[model samples]
Target: MSKTSQDEWTLEIKPVSGWFHFHLKDVWRYRDLLMMFVRRDFVAVYKQTILGPFWFFLQPILTTITFTVVFGNIARISTDGIPPLLFYMSGIVSWGYFSDCLTRTSSTFITNANIFGKVYFPRLVSPLSNIISLLMKFGIQLFLFTCFLLYYWMNGSTNVHPNIYILLTPYLLILMAGLGLGFGIIVSSLTTKYRDFSFLVGFGVQLLMYATPVIYPLSALPEKYKWIVLANPMTAIIDTFRYAFLGAGTFNPGNLIYSSVFMIVTLSIGILMFNRVEKTFMDTV
Candidate 1:
């Protein structure tokens, strides 16, 4: 081939040396592949299911009812004067998105090994696609929550008070997505070497939810125990989300700042480790 043709045909593969090096530009170049993966994830999940996407609505509603009965009535946990249904739904929807992203993305390496070995694309694309797919599900559940909010509003319930803080919803989601994607890719990378870690992800996420302020308001916790929950990066996001929509729970700017910093650090580390693992994961996986 001529010099120009040879240059056009040449493909260079370089070893990743430094910890901080990431080809984000390359990932952006393959955005079409990312979208394809997202479509596949969204469609494949509901393809054979009877209810299809309706399951998204059903899952949260049923869980809310169960929580209202068990936690609200049985345990008598305070909802900070907000209605029990709205209180639990707010926490549920936020927690559900974060958990779904974490759990699904954590298995990217193992689940997509066949494709990874067969073709070349940004390995991060799989997990990123999972995050996008979960966002879609979160939107549907959020709509359901809004419907309930409107119902309570029309009923003239003075207890349910939404405020300007509700504007933080987008930022809250970005934080959650960062945390989930960060923690998830880290776990996914580790699991390739030790399969035992896979079993713990589900159990660990369940335990982590209780550690977050999902079932009860953060304000209800005694002062001594408050710091323990605050240590979790998710606690602040969930607390602020509840406070914004329902006008209940602690809304500390300091906590939100801490959570944001934690997310950035975790995501940076996660991407670093993910880059290292992707180079050799196929061999061990």
Candidate 2:
């Protein structure tokens, strides 16, 4: 028997670890595919849309407006005397980024199984590229948030001025990426065996936003429920973001430690499981 050209060429993907465990070189080799995927995500996502990237900006804008109207003006949720717009926007900015990552990461397996089955690249490439694409979207939305931030900053809202914590903004970005990827990989791995995950992801993320402090402050939570709410790693991430932007939030050092530990543990597990799944997931998925 003679093998054809496609058959003769082998997929030589292998897993590596340490700081370089992700096989950066192999991922770099697939950079074109990564760029194509990013373009596909950007264009295909809103292909029929009139607004295009503006819609990305609008999502958090509309959300902050509704929350300002419903939860802020109507419900009179406390914002520590900061403008209702600023308070809600901070939460919206962080939540939008975190949730976007979470949703995108969660679908990595089911959404791209066809690509994985046909080709061999660093499996991490898919999620990593997705993360980069997501960051682009987040950057757009953050610009929208910044407009409001500047407005309030000029109005002297809440005695808030950007402070030392603001310097940790990059860490907050990494925190959002790590948490989303970690949680998403776990969900994607499970969904391979039990397909209930796809359903859960939609409703679950909505519920999680309320469960988090996206529209409300951690200061307003009932004493007992505060612990449960802050237990979410997004809690620290969001709080830190708000603290950085508005100079006010419930960002305890202990909470940051909790989130850091949780993210590290979950990300390690995610990589281990994803590596294991890359070998066999297509069989089940």
Model 2, runs deviating above 4 Å: 1-25
CA shift at 245, candidate 2, in angstroms?
A: 0.6
Stretches of candidate 1 off by over 4 Å are 1-10, 14-16
Candidate 1, residues 96-193: lDDT per residue as tens digits? 99999899999999999999999988899889999998999999999999999999999998998889999999999999999999999999999999
10 residues in a row with least lDDT, candidate 2: 13-22
Please write out the lDDT profile of model 2 over residues 1-285, one tens digit for every residue. Answer: 465666666665445333324455777888998898888777788887898777887888888899999998899988876788888988888788888888888888898888888987777778877888988888887888788788877876656766778778888899889988998888888888788987898899999988888888788889989878977888888888888888776668888889989999999888777777767787899
For model 1, the run of ten residues with the poorest summed lDDT: 1-10
lDDT, each prediction: 0.93, 0.82
